[model samples]
Target: MTAFPLLLLALAILSEVTATVCLRMASAGGGRWWIGVVAGYLTAFTLLAAVLAQGMALGVAYGIWAAAGVALTAVISRLVFKEPLTWVMSLGLVLIVGGVLLIETGAAH
Candidate 1:
């Protein structure tokens, strides 16, 4: 836990979510092109694999990564993709964050 790998995993998840949002935004325009989106996702996947190479368990890493990624992607979609934000969506995001917190707490044991 005191290793650089965990940080890398977090970073990879962040980058992955950002890339996903960017991809969505690009698709909305159809004219904006998607080379950046492609590059971002490629980099994200590579970094994720690098973190995995450092011996993190797949289940733990993937669960935290997916949950955090979804929450962050939702936020980014609202901001960058001009997606609407309802109270329900906001509450959902909160629950996702809470669940990820719980999972991480369990991982510490």
Candidate 2:
């Protein structure tokens, strides 16, 4: 997890989160948002592949990417869409962060 791969991973997570938000909007009758959904997902996967090509382990990279995406999407959705953000979901986010940290630590050893 050099800086470059880390940066790509971050970008991938952001792209995925953006795509998910776009999907939500599209489902809620914003048809034009679909283009954003498609483009965001394509960019996300491309950056993910680039991260893998940068020699990062799949499990570690994907674990971090997925966890960060979920966490960010949930928080952003709550803020942007006025969706629920209960204590249980917050706890889940904490757990996801902890899990990602464990995976990253394990990969370092």
Candidate 3:
């Protein structure tokens, strides 16, 4: 299939993960970070809408969005906040990625 939808979906996922990280940062100590939180989420949703308009299937787009967002957010948390990432949680993230891959490949066919 075309890659445009996947591009938009990737943007959506990036925006969402950025927003989530900013939200946590804001809650921690910096109220100014809330600006990033709001902007990131708004951008994310806008990108998501654009993806849908571009004919990306909702199931596939949203699945990839959520899976990638969760996976990236977890990694960011570990790096930025020094949060723990157990092996089990890492495996779960792997499964999420695998599921998203399945959805994408299925949509391609």
Measured by lDDT, the strongest candidate is 2
Tens-place lDDT per residue, model 2, 36-95, is 899999999999999999999999999999888888988898999998999999999999
* Candidate-wise lDDT, in order: 0.78, 0.93, 0.89
Candidate 1 per-residue lDDT, tens place, 1-109, comes to: 5578888888788778767766776777855547767777788788889888887767678877888888777777777667888899889888877887777678778
Decreasing TM-score order of the candidates: 2, 3, 1
Please give the lDDT score at residue 11 for candidate 1. Answer: 79
Error of 1 at 68 (Å): 1.9
Once superposed on the true structure, which residue ranges of model 2 sit more than 4 Å away at CA? none
What's the lDDT of the predicted structure labeled candidate 1?
Answer: 0.78
- Ranking 1 against 2 by lDDT, winner: 2
TM-score of 3: 0.91
Residue pairs with clashing backbones, model 1? none
Which has the better lDDT: candidate 2, or candidate 3? 2
TM-score of every candidate = 0.79, 0.96, 0.91
- For model 1, the stretches where C-alpha displacement exceeds 4 angstroms are 30-32
